[model samples]
Target: MLKVQEIRELIKLIDQSTIDEFTYEHEGEKIKMKKQILTAQAQTTLVQAPVETSPPALQKNTAQVEIQPGAQQHTEVAAPQVEEQRGENLAEVKSPMVGTFYHASSPDAEPFVKVGSKISADSTVCIVEAMKLFNEIEAEVSGEIMEILVKDGQLVEYGQPLFLVKE
Candidate 1:
């Protein structure tokens, strides 16, 4: 089995090379990767919803999104902007794979981490359910949990930031 760091290194290598696809299998574990080229305009699909209030200033934003390739999902543009305003001192704990994020192991259980909670690199921050498999996500960075980006049971995409930690 390959470690996350190893997989990340492999991705960097594959991305830098001219190779469009790569696959590897070992010990019943299989990994496959592919790259797709998209034009700048086609890469983003922005949607602006009608304003509910009579005033434009009242609404936070008209609504804008940057759609990912192969996934038509659109997220609020303000989230990232808010993240940026929070400052660069914060480190993001991103999702390794697309799945439903769960702060706790079960609905009735207490969450793994919360705002102001201190965490080590090995601490379990949350769980993501993908294909019925519950995968535990680590904090990976030693810091205090500053923000929770997604709600429990919300569907998250690959590489999407889940939590922000202040180191």
Candidate 2:
């Protein structure tokens, strides 16, 4: 376990650094933290509620999504098991492989996507550099990007949620 002061200092360091997210594993405790600016559009999604009246109504409403490259967005759908819970409609874009996630192709390149960016189905949203090779990731769903869960050049594990999109 980390002391409050230690956690505060870590957050301060992360705030001052150029990176957007930070993670460190010590002993059996794994801590992963991300710093997202929470753009205006993303803020709106938080307060919005899903229009869920029936089971079939939920799936029918989330049929179409559009994603674009360098500004890809993700959509949120209520989990099947959690349908009984009210007001949870968010989609997540997951990292396909295990490696370091890069927002851009290189250090000097612009980030592939950011909060409020639009993405399409074939758009290359980000890249995961592993074993000296860079693998481009695409947006499987199309929607307005609500949040960025990881920082550029951060080490991400497989199946991690990289972005959250509003559906």
Q: Please, what is the TM-score per model?
A: 0.55, 0.48
Per-residue lDDT over 11-69 for candidate 2, one digit per residue giving the tens place of the 0 to 100 score: 44454457655666666555555555421222112112222112122321111111222
Q: Give the poorly placed runs of model 1, Cα more than 4 Å off.
A: 1-19, 22-86
Please give the range of 10 consecutive residues that has the lowest summed lDDT in model 1: 49-58
Cα deviation at 125, candidate 2, in Å, is 1.1
TM-score, prediction 2: 0.48
lDDT of 1 by residue, 53-151 (tens): 121122222223222333343322111112222376788888776578999999999999999999999999999997688999998888899999999
User: For this target, which candidate reaches the highest lDDT against the unseen true structure?
Assistant: 1
